[model samples]
Target: MKLFECQNCGQPLYFENTVCESCGHRLGYIPDMNTVSALEPEGDQWRALASSGQLYRFCQNAELDACNWLIPSDHTETHCAACRHNRTIPNLADAENMARYRKLEMAKHHLFYTMIKLKLPLKNRIDDPQGGLAFDFLSDQVDANGNVTTVLTGHDEGLITINVAEADDAEREKRRTQMGEPYRTLLGHFRHEIGHYFWDKIVRDCGEEALEKCRAVFGDEREDYGQALQRHYNTGAPPDWQNNFVSTYATAHPWEDFAETWAHYLHIVDTLETARSFGIKVRPRIKLGHELEAQVDFDPHKANNIDELIENWLPLTYAVNALNRSMGQPDFYPFILSPAVIAKLGYMHELTH
Candidate 1:
């Protein structure tokens, strides 16, 4: 994430900030500009400080202490861009639910940020003809209400259901260990689930020719998803899977492989952007987009055709891993991208432009 500043006082601000500490200015993110700015009171609502002509209202959920985004009060859609996608939210009165919901909201915001940056269309189920891009932050077995049971995070159609338990550190860690996965987080879950949403909306429904190319790279997605998931749990992933798959789950089906690769692409691009913002040099005179495209040329000893991104990412991940060790925490990034994975990433990069 990029560092934000208070427009009034030039004080450093975080993405989640509602009020600037130094200047006490009210802040709201402008999705159209991908910026956070101070807001000035305008009659019953607020106006962007940069341009008083543009008006916005703090999301109603924000007033209820559940959101931090802004919306045009007179607009037909009442919910803010991020909040509109919520299909189910836990009982707000419940304290545990409030905490978990907050974490889920944070992850959701990040997902929206990335999606907007990629220029992807984001329509909620309510607005779409086929119920695309919906979310369900649900209470599960871990937080059982003497009724419904939840096992894991998953995607159905365009609806992404995330178990609220994943927001709890201990609960999430237990599941992480149980699954033998190196890395797992709320943001990662959002990215992975959205991958499924995009795959259906963009790739599958694009055209038959595009679908054929998608199958060529990710494999035919005609396999019965439920059966594949059941077999994966019963027999586990095949041996020598690491040679071809990005994650064990990816081996379950072609749809999963695409989702896993899509999530990894988001991870790589976001981390590389963070590195760039921090003035951490990776490749000389090479831009981020160019460097990312060049990562397909895998040189074991050095990042040859790849620009500063992969070059900088290698050392950055190592340093982060070492830092986590020093703090007795797990490695931040716990997956390796093989040559085949790099090629997949290249394809994703190609799709972006």
Candidate 2:
């Protein structure tokens, strides 16, 4: 995510800010321009200072304080580009559910920001009912007898289901510990699941040629997915799994491998952009011949290759990890990037390009 400035006061701003801290101006994100604007009331509509002469309104979800995105006043759709893809939302009347849904929306909006910056294709279910992006934020169901049926978070075709409980910090941390995962978050979930959705569009539906290329990188996805997952859970990842897969769970199947790598790719580029926005640089004293020095002066989204991203990412991660250690926190990034992982990330770069 890029750093933003309040048009009214020129103060530094964040993507999710609904009001300017300095100038006390209302703020709304205009997706078409990829910037947040200070709004001026004009009858029932708002005039965006960042995009002059245009009238806009906040998404209908704004009524619930769940969205800050804006739609052009002339557009027919009331929902913003991001919220329009939501097929199902939790019961907002329940205060707990409403709070969880808010957290989910925050992460979902961050995911959409990266996708829009990358110029990825986005079609809501309304646009293509058979195969279009959609979200279902669901809670576990309970029977009259008090038997609970858990909702597993995963992607099916273009629909992504998120167990709303994942939005709770304690619940998510408990699951992360139980699963033995080094990293897990709502944004990571969104990125990983959307990776599967893109695979459908960029590989499976492309043709035999595209499928062959993807298979060469991610292995044969034709293998029985259920059996692969069952075996993974039964025996766990191989001893040397780190040499090949991005995460232990990635070893479950080829589809998972692709999604894990894809999520990491998104993590790298987006975090690097944030570093660049703040003009962050890492140049450690007594460095080993520029091995731990990086100047993020270019956009990662338009990086020439995966190697370019990795080169900067390593130094940044090292500095961040050290800072986290100083604060008695866990390592900011606990995963390793082996040579094999780099190669897979290269394939992801190619696919996105």
Please give the CA lDDT of all the candidate structures. Answer: 0.77, 0.95
Candidate 1 residues 213-320, lDDT tens each?
A: 888888889889889889999998999787788899888889899999899878876766655555553233345544423222221212232333455566667666
Predicted candidate 2 versus true structure: per-residue lDDT over 1-353, tens digit per residue: 89999988899999999999899999999998999889999999999999969899999999898899999999999899999999999999999999999999999999999999899989999999999999999999999999999999999989999999999999999999999998889999999999999999989999999999999988999999999999999999999999988899888999999999999999999999999999998999874847788999999999999999999999999999999999999899999999999999999998899
lDDT of 2: 0.95
Q: Count the backbone clashes (under 3 Å) in each candidate.
A: 2, 0
TM-score of each: 0.87, 0.99
Q: Which portions of model 1 show Cα errors greater than 4 Å?
A: 141-148, 282-309
Give the CA lDDT, 0 to 100, for residue 163 in model 1. 87
Q: Which ten residues in a row have the lowest lDDT in candidate 2?
A: 284-293
Which candidate should be chosen as best, given lDDT against the real structure?
A: 2
With candidate 2 superimposed using the best TM-score fit, by how many Å does residue 275's alpha carbon deviate from the native?
A: 0.5
| Number of the top-ranking candidate, with TM-score as the measure | 2
